[model samples]
Target: MRSRSAPPTVRDVAARAGVSPGTVSKALNGTGQLRAATRDRVAAAAEELGFRPNHLAKSLLEGRTYTVGILTSDSFGRFTTPVMVGIEDALGAGRMSTLLCDGRGDPLRERHYVQELLNRRVDGLVVTGRRPDPRPSLGRLPIPVVYVLVQSDDPEDLSLTYDDVQGAALATEHLVASGRKRFAHVSGPERHWSTQRRREGVGRALEAADLPLAPELVLLGQWSEAWGRTAAAQLLRRDSGVDAVVCGSDQIARGVADGLREAGADVPGRVAVVGFDNWDVMVEAARPPLTTVDPNLTALGQHAATRLMDAIDGKELPRGVHRQPCDLVVRQSSV
Candidate 1:
C-alpha cells in the first residue's frame, strides 16, 4: 500500500494485483506477452489504485514533449481566434498540447514570449499575426517553426496564409456577373498589405472585364463603419451611377449599406454591396445580410499546425509561402 499523501505507483499496483513489479510494468505497457488474465488483473488493480501514468516521464523517454507553442501578436483578434481554434483542432487530433502566448504587437513583448516558450522546450512553434504582412523572423532556433496567417521575412521559413488577391477578385467578379458595370472600391488603410492586394485584385478583375475603376471611384480610408459611411456618401456624390460598391471588410459593408439607404438607393436593386472577411456579426446583422468573401482562415491554421507537426515528426518541411484559396458567400446584398 502506498502512503495516503503519495500517488500510487506501478509497485503499488503490482502489490495489489499479486504480481511482480516487472510483470506489472510489462502488463501496464502491453508488452512482455503477459497472459490475458494477468494483464486484466494488473489493469484492474491500476484502476482501483487510481494510478495515472506519468506522461512527462513517457515523453522524456521518447525524446519528445508532444507540446507546441503558439506565439501570436493578437491573441484574441477576430482573425487569430478562428486560426487558433483550427490549430487546436489539429493538435488535439494528434494528442498534442499547446502553450499560447500573446505578444500584443510589441517587439519587446514578443521577444520575451519567444524566450519563455523556448525555455519550456516546446517541440515546435507556430508564429501567427493579426495581419497578413511579412513579419520579422524569430531567427534560427533548434526546433522547427511554422508561420500562420503571415509569412516570415525569411523566405526559407514555412508559412500558411490565404490568397487575399483572389478573395478580392472573387468579390469583384460576383458583382460584375450580377450586371453591375459601374464599380467602386472602398477599403481599409492604404498601407496594409492585404488592402493593397485586395485593391490590386479588384483592379485586375475590372481590367479583365474591360471596365475601369477610375481614380475617383477608389476610396482608401480607415476600416470602420464611420469611414464606410463617409466613403459611400462621397462615392455616391461623385458617381450616383455607381451600380455596385465593394468594401474591404464586413463592417465597412454594413456602413455602406446604411449610406446607400440614406441616399435613397435600393440595396442590390440600385446599388449592390459586397464585402470581404465574411464576419458573421456584421454580415448577419445587416438589414439585408451581406455577400462577402470567406478567407478560410481556420483552414490555414489547420494546415500550418499539421505542417509543423510533420516537421516535428522528422518529415521534410517545405519552405516559402503556401497560400490557401478563399470562397464567396452569396447573400441578399449581392443578389
Candidate 2:
C-alpha cells in the first residue's frame, strides 16, 4: 500500500506499471501513441494506487479555468431554484464549479455581478431569469454566455426557454379529454409574453375541438391567489355552467378551487380545474391535487449549460431562441 503521509503520484504509478514516467503521462492524457496493453496497464496501476490528478494544475497548463458564473434575477424564487439545480447537476459532471450571483432584478446589481465574475476569469457565464421575457443583452464578453428561461434582445446571443403555448395546449387538451364542454380561462396580465402565449394556446385548443373561447369568459388578472379568487367569483356569477377553468398558475388554481367550493360547485364532479407551472407545493397541497402544465425548468437549465459548454469547447452554436417542450401532470382536479 502507498504511504499514508501523501497520495500516490505519477512516478509511483509508472513504477508500479513497469513503464517510463513520460509514457505514463502520455497514456493518462491520451496524447501520445502507445500500445493498448501499455495503456491498460497504466490505468489499472493508477486505479490500484488511488492516484488522483491535480485538475487545477491541468487547467492552468491548458490556459482554461474550469469554473462558470451564473447570474440570476431571483435565486430564491421557485421558478429559478429548479433551473439552478439543473445547471449545477450538469456542470458538476463536467468537473466544473459555479459562482452564483443574485441581481434581484436591478440593472446596477447585475452589472456589478458581471464585473465580479469577469474579474474571477470564469470560463463561461449563464444568465437566468424568473420570467421568459426579453431583456437587454449583456453585451460582448471574453467568455461564452447562454441565457436561461429568458431571451437577450441581441440577436447574436443564444437563449433557452419553455414552450408556454405547448404547455397550455396540453393542459387544455387534458381538460377537454375529461369531457369538459363549457370552459373559461383565468390568467395573468396580458402584457406578459407567457400570458399571451398561454391564452392563445387555450383558444387554439378549443378551436381544434370545434369550440370557442368566448371573450367574456376569459379573465385577465394578476398572477396571484387573490386574483384567482376574484376571477373565479366573477366567472361563476357570469356563467355557473362552466365545466372547467384553465388557470395561468398553480397558485391561482388553488384560489379557484376554494372559490368553487364556496360557490357550491363540486370539484371534478361539476367543475374541473387545470393550472400552469407544476410547482409541487401548490399542486400537492390543494384540497384535491391540482392538475397542471410543467414548464420543465430543470430541463431548460440543463440545455443551457450544455450549450455553453459546447461553445466553450470551440463548437459553433447557433444564435437565437431555443424552445424546450413541456408536458401535463394529471390530478384529481382535472380527472
Candidate 3:
C-alpha cells in the first residue's frame, strides 16, 4: 500500500484498475471513448485511492488554463459583492478558477490589470462597474470578455445590465394603479444614464395614463437623502396636490419620506412614495419600509459567466447589449 501522505499517481491507479497509463488518462481526463464498465472501474479506483489528476499537465495537453479573470471598477464592492458570488458559484461548478482585480475607476490601473490578467493566460474575462452608463469598449483582446452592470459602447460586445427604463415604469405603473395621480419625479445627477432612462420610464408610464410628467414636476439633483428631503419641500411648495412621488434611489426616497413626515404630511395617505434600488439598508431602515426596484444583479453576473464559458468553449459571443429586467419590491411606503 502507498503511504497516506503521498498522493497516488496515474501509474499506480492504472496498475490497480487493470488498465494502461494511456487508458487511465483517457478515462480520467474524459479524452477518448471508453466502455462504461472501464470508465466506472477507473472512477471507482480513483475514488478509493484519492487520485487527483495533475491539472498543470492537463492544461499543457489541452492548451487551456481553466481559469477566468474578473475585473471591476467598484472598489467599495457594494455592487460587485453579490455579482461576484453568482459568478463564483457558476464558474466553480465547471472547475474553473477566478482571479479578481479592482480598477477603482482609474484608466491606468485598469490597463495595468488587464495586461496582468492577459499575462496570466486566463481563458476569459468578466468586466463590471457600478455605473449604469455605457463605456468605451475595452477593444478586441486575445480572450472573450463579458460586461456586467456597465455596458460596452460597442453594440457587438455582449453587455448585460439591468433595464432601468422598465424598472422605473414598473414603479410608476404600480402607483398609478393604486389610484394616485398628479405624479412628481426625484432623481440623481441629470447626466447619469440611469437618471435619464428612469425619468423616461416614469414619463412614458404617466403619459399612458394621460398624465405626462411636466417640466416643473421633474426634479433632478444629486443622489442624496438631503437632496431628497429638500426636493420633498420643493414639491410641496410647487405642487401640494401631487399625491405620488417616484425617486431614482432608495436613499432619496427615504429622505423624501422623512421630509413629508416632518412637514406634517401622512405617508401613503397624503403622499405615496416609491424608490429605485431595493437596497436593504436604505429601504428597511426607513420610517416606513420603502417600495423599490431590485436590479437583480446576481442573475446578471451568472449570465455573464455562462457566456464567457460558452465563448471559451469555441462558441461565438452573442452580439448586442442584453438588458436584464428588474423586479419591483412592494412595501408600506407605496401602499
Ordered from best to worst lDDT, the candidate numbers read 3, 1, 2
Model 1: residues >4 Å from true position, as ranges? 1-51
- Which whole-number lDDT from 0 to 100 does residue 94 have in model 1? 84
Residue-wise C-alpha lDDT for candidate 3, range 133-181, written one tens digit per residue: 9887888999999999999999989999899999999999999999997
**TM-scores for every candidate against the unseen true structure:** 0.88, 0.91, 0.91
RMSD of every candidate to native, in Å, equals 3.5, 2.5, 2.4
- Where is model 2 more than 4 Å wrong at Cα? 1-4, 20-50
Per-residue accuracy of model 1 over 130-209 as CA lDDT, tens digit each: 88999989888889999999889998898889998999999999998989999999999989998999999999999999
- Residue 120 in candidate 3, Cα distance off native in Å: 0.4
Q: Against the true structure, whose lDDT is highest?
A: 3
In terms of TM-score, how similar is model 3 to the real structure? 0.91
* Model 1 per-residue lDDT at 242: 96
